[model samples]
Each structure stands twice: as C-alpha cells, then as structure tokens.
Target: MYAYDTITEAVSDLKKRGYTKDFNIRENRLACDQLDTHFGHEDFEIIEVYRFEGPSDPADEAIVYAIEAPSGALGILVNGYGMYADENNSEFLQQLHERVRLKS
Candidate 1:
C-alpha cells in the first residue's frame, strides 16, 4: 500500500491523469458512505489509490483503487480505474510511489 503526504496530492495526481474530482468523490462516498456499509466511518484508516496490470480482459486492464475504510477494518476495492498516459499518470504514480510512505 502507498501513502500520500496529503489527500490533496493524491487527488491532484488523479485529476492530472484525466480523473475528475466527481469520480473520486463519488467513489469514495459510495465506498465509505452509508451507515451499514462495509467501509463505513468506522472500518479502516487509509484510502489508497494505485494501478495494476489487470487481467486478460480489456476491462480488466485498468487502474485499481483500494480504500481502508474507517468502520470494520475492511479493505474496499474500487475497480475499473483509468488514466491518461499523455498527461502524467506514470509520473504521478512514480512520484507517489517514491515519495509516499506505505503500510506494512
């Protein structure tokens, strides 16, 4: 898991990579919202954003987002992630990977 100095930096990196605030906010809210949700306000403590090579499917070749909810210590997975390589997805990811801390 990667760590960000600030959530804003993470969000900015995502935005630069063609992700919008609406998308992130929506995903976060959906994953962490709702009183009885698995990732409610009492689960985990970290919200992580990263990318993986994905499986053999086209849809599978996407970025993956994982959030540590604040409720049940659950690790919520948000799939179907995308980014604009022309922008700075790689750079951002590299920087984040190099700069941000990680959970053991």
Candidate 2:
C-alpha cells in the first residue's frame, strides 16, 4: 500500500494504476454514470482503502476507496466519514468493509 498525503494524490495515483472510473455513493449501490452502471455489495470489491484525517477540522476527514467490479470495471469511491457521513452510504460501505475484513 502507498501512503498518500491527500485524497487527490491517492486518487490521481490510483487512476494511473487503472482505477479510472469515478463512483458515486448511492443509497444502496455504487453508481458510475460514465459507464451507466451501478453495483451492489456483491458486485464489487474494495481493493484498497486510504483514510485521511483533518489537522484541525473533522470535516476534512475522508476515505478514498479503490474498487473493482467483477466485470473488470475499476473505480474510486471518495467519501467523508464519521458523523457527517451519509447514513445510507455509511451503512452500505460498512458492509463492504466487513466483507473485506473477513476475506483477509
């Protein structure tokens, strides 16, 4: 795994590594409008997780996830964590996190 100084740095490097799509966190799935596709928890796996902490403000906290779908689609999911996180997306992502943990 690589250490990234910022979310932009991690995303840029991952894109270079072929995680080229952008995924949006939906209520129940990850959506990529560019591909006109959406994925459920079973459809994709989290390849990498990079978390960032704010120096002074909690709102700056974020996580960048490298995700790959079973169909070979590669993408990135950038989300804010903690109290400010979206309820639906947070629950959705937590299930994914658990899956990855169990797989490891």
Candidate 3:
C-alpha cells in the first residue's frame, strides 16, 4: 500500500504513469483509460475504477481498482489506500504486486 497524503496525489502518480482520466460520474467512482494500446499488453488487464465508500467515515473509505492478469488471476486493489504514518497503511501494493508479477 502506498501512503499518500491525499487522493489527488495517488491519482496524479497513476496519471503520470500513463493512466488517463477515462470517466467520472458517480460521487465515488472514477474510471481511467486503459494502459494498453492493443490487446495483451502487460498481462495485467486493468478493469473498473472505483472509489471507496463507508457508512460513516469518509477517510476510512478509499479509492479502489480492479485488475485481472492474463493468467486468469484476479485482484481488486491499488497503490493509494492506507495509513500515512505507519500503523494504518493497508498492503495495497502487495496486492497489486501479486497481480502485476503474474506470468503473462
């Protein structure tokens, strides 16, 4: 899990890495354009873009993404959710790494 000071920072980092702003409609939903120009790009098929939601705590809620690798492995996670200091950051990167390192 990447610790970001704010959601914008995370979004910016992804955008810089070739992720484009694809869509935004729902209050908590944001869709990013595909990273691949053609089929079978990175073995990791980027899926839906989502923002986290909770009943009471907005901070607890985080933005999430769904990713699927070419090998049929599935994981729904990203690099922007967790605690800033140390004790709260979720292992989102670990989840992402699991999918990213798949054998395409």
Candidate 4:
C-alpha cells in the first residue's frame, strides 16, 4: 500500500486516475451525488483505500475508498472515523470498513 499526505491530495490524484464519482454514506447504502445513484453493500466493490489522520486531532481522521459498482461505475467514498462519526447506519458502515480493511 502507498501513503498520501492528505485527503485532498489523494482525492485529486484519484480523480485523475478515474475515481470520478463521489459516494456519500447514506442510512443503509452509499450514494453517488453526481450520478444520483444508490448502492448497497452487495452492489459494489472496493478497489483501493487511503486513510488519513489529523496529525493531532482525531476529528481529522478519515478514509477514502475507491469503489466500483455493478454497473461499471467507479467512485470514491470519504468516511470519517472515531468520535463524531454518524451511526444511524452503523451496521452498514462497519461492514464496509471491515471488508476493505480486511481485504486491503
């Protein structure tokens, strides 16, 4: 695995490499704002992941996941970790995190 100094840098470079869509965490699925699409855990696959820390603040901790959907759509999911994380869909989030962490 490689390292990225910052999420912005990773995002810019990933976009250049074809991770163009942005996936947001929804209650029970991932949503691509640009494509207006929703995907459940079974509907997509993780291609890459880039984790980042605040250096001093835990609030800055986040993970960028390169994702691919069944329709051949590619995207990125940016999720924060630790305290202050959204838990309304904790189960789905945990599964996604575990899958990538374990696979990667």
User: Number of the top candidate by TM-score?
Assistant: 4
Model 3 ranges with Cα > 4 A deviation: 23-44, 47-60, 66-104
My TM-score estimates for the predictions, one after another, are: 0.31, 0.88, 0.31, 0.90
TM-score of 1: 0.31
Candidate 1 per-residue lDDT over residues 1-104, each given as its tens digit: 44445344545565565433232223223333333443322234435555544345444433434444433333333334344332323443343334325642
Candidate 1 displacement at residue 24 in angstroms: 11
Please list the C-alpha lDDT of all candidates, in the order they appear: 0.40, 0.86, 0.43, 0.85
On a 0 to 1 TM-score scale, where does candidate 4 land against the true structure?
0.90
Identify the runs in model 1 with alpha carbons over 4 angstroms from their true place: 1-28, 32-35, 38-44, 47-50, 54-57, 83-104
Error of 2 at 56 (Å): 0.9
Q: Per-residue lDDT for 1-104 in model 4, tens only? A: 55789999889888888889889988779888788889887689898898888978998899889989888888888888888578887988988878876895
- lDDT by residue for model 3 (17-92), tens: 5454332212222222342221223335656455544456545556545455454443443433444212232243
The candidates, ranked best first by TM-score, are 4, 2, 1, 3
Q: Which residue ranges in model 4 land beyond 4 Å of their true spot? A: none
Question: Quick one: ranking by lDDT, best first?
Answer: 2, 4, 3, 1
- The C-alpha local distance difference test score for the whole of candidate 1 amounts to 0.40
